[model samples]
Target: MSFALSTTVDLDFDRTVAALREALSTQGFGILTEVDLSGTLKTKLDVDVPRQLLLGACNPAYAYRALQAEERVGLLLPCSLTVRAGADGRTLVDAMDPALMVELTGTSALTEVAAEVRSALRAALDALETR
Candidate 1:
């Protein structure tokens, strides 16, 4: 299965990032971390690239449940979401598929938690459609 739920929006990069954050929040997620991929690459490797951001999104309730199911699940604690500029000047968003956690951990116990997370992530992505 594909590992990500992705969508493209017509907004500019910064606006798309803001919209993504808002959409996630509406679905009970919060941005735990943000990594500017473009800036990082430029600063660390001296290479220029299109604007890109990585957002670590977490829904605490789901996180707690996942942790309870598997102690090592922290390895996948926060779901990753990305907002990047496309070559055509549009914005692209991609969110990790939570179901992957179940496959990676080899545990059926995480099925419910993963389903919930997947639903929330899907909702967040759907919200972007209105933008």
Candidate 2:
């Protein structure tokens, strides 16, 4: 199974990142954290790589539901998505598949919550494509 739902945007890295943030917000996901992956690597290791950013997106309603179902699930509370400049001259956006939570936790209680989060993520991706 694909671990992520991804798309290639015709826009440049900066534009794609902005568009993705707006799309995610439209789907009720607030970015809780932002990590400059490539910048960090370059600063620490002196390695050059494609521009990349990691966003920790979260929908409070789904997060609350998931936690109610399983306390330990907090470890995976925020959904992670990556935006990067692809070698092909376009920007790539990849979002984690929420269904994995159900499979990993082995908790039937999280099934509905996972599906809901997955749907929102799908909507965000769909919006990016159709926009």
lDDT for each of the candidates? Answer: 0.92, 0.90
Clashes of 1: 0
The estimated TM-scores of all candidates read 0.98, 0.96
Cand. 2 TM to true fold:
0.96
Q: What is the lDDT of candidate 2?
A: 0.90
Looking at candidate 1, what is the lDDT of residue 101?
95
Off by over 4 Å in 2: none
lDDT of 1 by residue, 21-119 (tens): 899999899989999999999999999999999999999999999999998999987999989999998999999999999999998999999999999
- Top candidate on lDDT is 1
